[model samples]
Target: MTTGHPFMQAHPHQPLSIAAKILSPQMIQTIRKLPEFHLQAWKILDRWAFNSPEMLAQLEAQGEIVLMSRLLDQQAVEHQALMDSTHQLQNGMTEHEILEMCEIHTEL
Candidate 1:
């Protein structure tokens, strides 16, 4: 809400960044230091906010904060899946064997 925040340094005619208004200053700094993929995800969320102001406000009013931890949890799951597949391949498991282990049926 402070006009002196870095995110508020936008051109006089431009609106302040959504992250500045919604996220804590520490959160903004941390997000700025995150990887490109994470930054892209934030950009997507910001666009969603721009497109759905009323919904965002309603969620905020209800005390619903965005859960970046869920994203990290999902990333961990995906990374574990990839590591498992890589290990299987290294152990000479054929693609068919891996697919079968994963219960994914495919027509050869």
Candidate 2:
């Protein structure tokens, strides 16, 4: 925990209220589009005061952030794969087939 960190100066009782104000519109939009699991993880990260030593220690003990980050990374890889597949299919695949492929991908 750094004393000079922005979260250190954040209103301790407000959680994400101050943090949300600092996020760019594009960043917020990107977060909004995340899947429910990842969205929940982001919310947890957003709500924590990382600059407080006690909170930081507790967070490290919980290991939630590391798990969330790994999950998000895996999701990004899957999303990129799907996007690439969709682009390749756009050459000749029918709309119905594309939709079906997306549904199938999501099921996994």
Candidate 3:
């Protein structure tokens, strides 16, 4: 689910937002078109962020800025609220939730 956008900000274990969850390859394609923005996110990636450089390159090389902008928009959307949104699952997909869910429920 990377476009090599140089953002390197995607958490390996975390679920990407809906845009990514639904359109991964397409997202990467969007980033390939916007190198500058990708680089910006890249600066923030690490153990505390999206630290994978190889994944970043995949996003950038694909020109998936729509996905890049979508990623930024995901951040911006949260910035507008400044509240906690960790428990809410996107589109009711328990497996798609970023935080780990109850394994018992998922296994059922």
Candidate 4:
């Protein structure tokens, strides 16, 4: 992916304006020159990318990549939270409970 790609964001909670920085000149041109022929057709350019299979595939692939990245990111956050909670509790769960939580986390 190119620089400034949404998936390349360094932080999960970065502002949307940062993601919007991906609109390069070439992307703008590509958007302007999309091949829509029917004047009477009620399709909006914003929705055209979803209607094109190739474009949709690209978007879906990127979407999947983003989703997987976020999923892993969330697990890291949850694990850190659990560790922090354990530290604060001064007494942790039994070995069986830890093993069960590990199993459930991996299944997710």
Best by lDDT: 1
Clashes of each: 0, 0, 23, 0
Candidate order by TM-score, highest to lowest? 1, 3, 2, 4
Candidate 2 segments exceeding 4 Å error: 1-62, 87-108
Better of 1 and 3 by TM-score: 1
Instruction: Tell me how many residue pairs clash in candidate 1.
Output: 0
* lDDT (10s digit) by residue, model 1, range 35-61: 732533354335334555565445445
lDDT tens digits by residue: candidate 2, 24-90: 4444455456564453234333534243435433434556455346436545554455566776546
Q: lDDT per prediction? A: 0.45, 0.43, 0.36, 0.35
Better of 1 and 4 by TM-score: 1
Root-mean-square deviation per candidate: 15.4, 16.0, 12.9, 16.7
TM per candidate: 0.33, 0.27, 0.28, 0.24
The window of 10 residues in a row where model 4 has the poorest summed lDDT is 37-46
lDDT by residue for model 3 (46-90), tens: 211334445544544566554355456544433323223333433
> Distance from true position, residue 5, model 4, in Å?
35
Error of 3 at 2 (Å): 30
Task: Give residue 89's lDDT in candidate 3 (0 to 100).
Answer: 32
Candidate 1 worst ten-residue window by lDDT = 1-10
Using lDDT, rank the candidates from best to worst.
1, 2, 3, 4
The alpha-carbon lDDT assigned to residue 104 of candidate 2 equals 29
Model 4 over residues 1-108: C-alpha lDDT tens digits? 123222222434323222123323443343334443221111111222323435433443475445334334544544554564574335645322442455533221
